[model samples]
Target: MVEIKDFKASDCNALWNINRNAFRKSLKKESYEEFKNITENSIGKVIFLENEIIGAIFLKSQSEVGTFKVEKFFICPKYQNRGLGYFILTHLPEEDTSIKKIELDIDESSLKAKKFCEKMKKEI
Candidate 1:
């Protein structure tokens, strides 16, 4: 089963490793530092499959009320190509009914993410 939890200080390394692996192809060495800085300010949630951490998501409140912008979101490379992403995206609203909308900016280099987002749009 998949579970979601609030990010804790101890989960930093685990979450960083997941994000790093997921974007290894698109991010340069220096970009990781930027990621750390950005995540520090955003509200984060960790994704867990059973007892293991599989992914994380960071969000920032948008100017529009009840809207949140995704700052960083990634599932570990080992867990990709499963239905987990769709499951999490679809169920996120259930975790917080106050969230009226979720928005994100995908990296142009990651066509897989783009396609996934498109699929999500069609499904929703």
Candidate 2:
């Protein structure tokens, strides 16, 4: 089963490793710094399958009520294509009923991620 939990200090290293391995090209020094900044500054959460850490998400509340901006989100490369991402996207409302909208920013070049988000939107 997949689980979502509050981010703990102890999760730092595992989350770093997961992000590093998941988006090898994107986790360069500058981007890693950005990741650290976001994780430290935002509301962070960790995603797990069984007891293993598999992903992380960082979000910040937007100005609008019940709106949140996704700063970063990633599932470990090894854990992709297992319906976990879809589940997380769809089920977050169950975890926080106050969430009226979830917003994400994706680079134009990241076609795969855009597609995934689109699919999730359709499902929703």
Candidate 3:
């Protein structure tokens, strides 16, 4: 079963590995490091499957805009295309009462992500 939980500092290495493998061609070690550092101190969620870390997402408060920004979302390569991304997005509002609008910046090159978001909108 897949489980979502608060990000933990101890998850650094495993999370990095997931990030690294997920975006091999575009992987940025420094960015992942920064993400790990920030997530360790910030409020975010991590997805685990059978005790193995598989995905990570970070949220930032954008109360000024009345939205919750999805700062980061990454899933390991092996776990992609399994509807987990949609699951995370669908449950974001339940995780926080203050979150009304869910916002994210998707790379223009990532057609799959754009399509996933479109699908999520329909699902919600």
Error in Å for residue 67 of model 2: 0.6
Q: Which one wins by TM-score: 2 or 3?
A: 2
By TM-score, how accurate is candidate 3?
Answer: 0.78
Misplaced by over 4 Å in model 3 are 27-32, 40-42, 109-111, 117-124
| Higher-scoring candidate on TM-score, 1 or 2 | 1
lDDT of 2 by residue, 1-124 (tens): 8888888878988898898776665423436567687888988879988999999888799999988887778899988888888888777768777777788665343566777767765665
Alpha-carbon lDDT, every model: 0.80, 0.78, 0.75
Q: lDDT of candidate 3?
A: 0.75
lDDT of 3 by residue, 1-124 (tens): 8788888778877887887776665524447658666676556888988988898987887757547677667899888999889888877678656667777765444566667666666765
- Best candidate according to TM-score: 1
Task: Assess candidate 2 and give its TM-score to the true structure.
Answer: 0.85
Poorest 10 consecutive residues of model 2 by lDDT?
23-32
Q: Comparing candidate 2 with candidate 3, which one achieves the higher lDDT?
A: 2
Q: In model 2, where do residues sit more than 4 Å from their true spots?
A: 26-31
Q: Which lDDT tens digits does candidate 1 get at residues 22-79?
A: 9778744435568777678887878999979999888798899978887777999989
Q: Residue 94 in model 2: shift from native, Å?
A: 0.9
What is the full ranking by TM-score, best candidate first? 1, 2, 3
Candidate 3, 77: how far from true, in Å? 0.8
